[model samples]
Target: MKTMTRPRYRLAIAAVAAATALTACGGGSTGADGGLPSNVSFGGGASGAIYGVLATGMAEIVNTNLQGVNARAEATAGGLQNTRLVRDGELTFGLTDPRVVYPAVRASGEFADEPPAEDLRFVMNGYPSLYQVTALDPNIRSIGDLRGKRVCTAAGIQTAMLGELLTPYGLAVGDLSLSNLEWTECADRMKAGDIDVIGYAGGPGAAVLIQAFAGSPTAHIVGIDPDKATAMSAQFPWWKPSTLPAGTYDGQTAEVPTVEISGGTLVTRADTSEELVHQFLTALESHFDQFSKVHPLASYYSLPGTATNTMSDVLPTHPGAARFYRDKGIPGY
Candidate 1:
């Protein structure tokens, strides 16, 4: 048999933990030693994606540090799916964005098919999911420049957010020839001159952006003009102003102004035991130094940032998480 690396071995252990935890997805059973669940099902993002990697690392940390709690990260279709699963109690914990959770709370936008997930509770903050507007045409300096150009917005959550982004410029998705392709396909089309622009959202060093930028010399990320970014943030409170500093990517020598969702909010049901949530936060805090090594995006997180901006004001923090932060004197909690 081939030798499995340490990471792979950890994930294999988590897979077995997941199988044992499946029956407990409805709401976990308390462990004998503590009020915390004996098994935990954490809904992570798409398989092989960055969010998935973060979720896997988190579970590994918990399993290694938090005795009596078995945490398993399960692959999911990203935030939207994770939100629904968490709301319905099919997942004990989930990773998602405040933007995605906000709409689900109101039962609007992509979540219109289901009732409002009013019970969703924010546990912790992750990192920014900044929108990177890239184009192969150097002449496309601003969003307005793509009036009649072919644009690919990826699809689902991204398509909706990008459509909203165009509104401040007096442009709509209909104004451009739109394609709902996947990020990989968008990169390919952009390279082939089939698409004029790509609207994608992810952490700074997202893999798809790296692929798109490397494939075409002309492909470069464009900044959202300042006024538009401000207006968009005003209209969508979940968005925060962010700057993509110079040299963030190869050949990109200047900073770019952008608006991003404070993504990676760890959410759970409101009824989750306060002790359990507190214990969960404790486990994460103790392993903070090692987390960045597990995933680079985690480096963006800080106690102050997490306490104040993990989720929007509209979403309430669980009492357990709130207590944990308060005890640590993390200011905004």
Candidate 2:
């Protein structure tokens, strides 16, 4: 296994510049209800990504459920960016992963120096995001097998999570030829044989994986070893061992065990009125079927215990959300 080198100074400088540009353009104004308009804006992932679609569907659901609120979903870089936007009040809401929320809240670890953006709160859990490790080589069977091979972990949060996911298996970025590419780019690289494996953490029924396997029948999801998966979960509380059942996609027949995490969170500012948060959840529960119609992933949003169970531990539930749960016999700390 080879280690990944630190990104060049030029790349770091460019990233800073890009972040500044985004910060400047992303912030929006608050609406009359102290909520952004029903046309409230949501920050989503890259174009054509599942999170992007999920955001659009959520916006539609919110807009349809509330009389004055109209939600609009916009493409974003991903979780870290969305967190920053939501904290800054640039977006009324956004979809984010539970793992990313932890470091940001602790104001240590990866997000050190940028203290936890305390204002964030959860609306609901979207889906389960399983870490899928796929390789073009049939001989590679586990995370450890790709020691010297080229591995593409999609950019931003996905890349960060992949690094964390491999730690317990004794694999690090240094062990493989690491390529930080976008999911679409990673899929394309895998199809071109430029990368030996692509590690992705995404909502169930990911289109990217489906397309990649369809393009190259040789490409397949390499199952994580159960013992390794269990150990990884113990090391990272946010991650739990999970499986993707067969029939999710063509040629994928057996349930593959892997480390899983909450796919998305509906977050809002802490200062937002409790009444508004309650109203939002009320609307969501009442029109779940309408929301599910917005995106297939929304089906998970309908689970009975979805809201209370999947919230990121790092984020304190909004007072509004806490109240709603308390009424239903789910205690809030």
Q: Write the per-residue lDDT of candidate 1 for residues 65-184, one digit (tens) a residue.
A: 878878888876677777887888778788888778878999987788899999988888888889888888999999888788888866567877887788789998778888887678
lDDT of 1: 0.78
Shift in Å, residue 7, candidate 1: 32
Where does candidate 2 have its weakest 10-residue lDDT segment? 1-10
Candidate 1, residue 114: the lDDT equals 90
How does candidate 2 fare on TM-score?
0.82
Top-lDDT structure, candidate number: 1
What's the lDDT for residue 145 in model 1?
Answer: 86
Question: Model 2, stretches more than 4 Å misplaced?
Answer: 1-39, 215-218, 311-313, 326-333
| Candidate 1 lDDT for residue 333 | 66
Reference-based lDDT, each prediction: 0.78, 0.72
What TM-score would each prediction reach against the true structure?
A: 0.87, 0.82
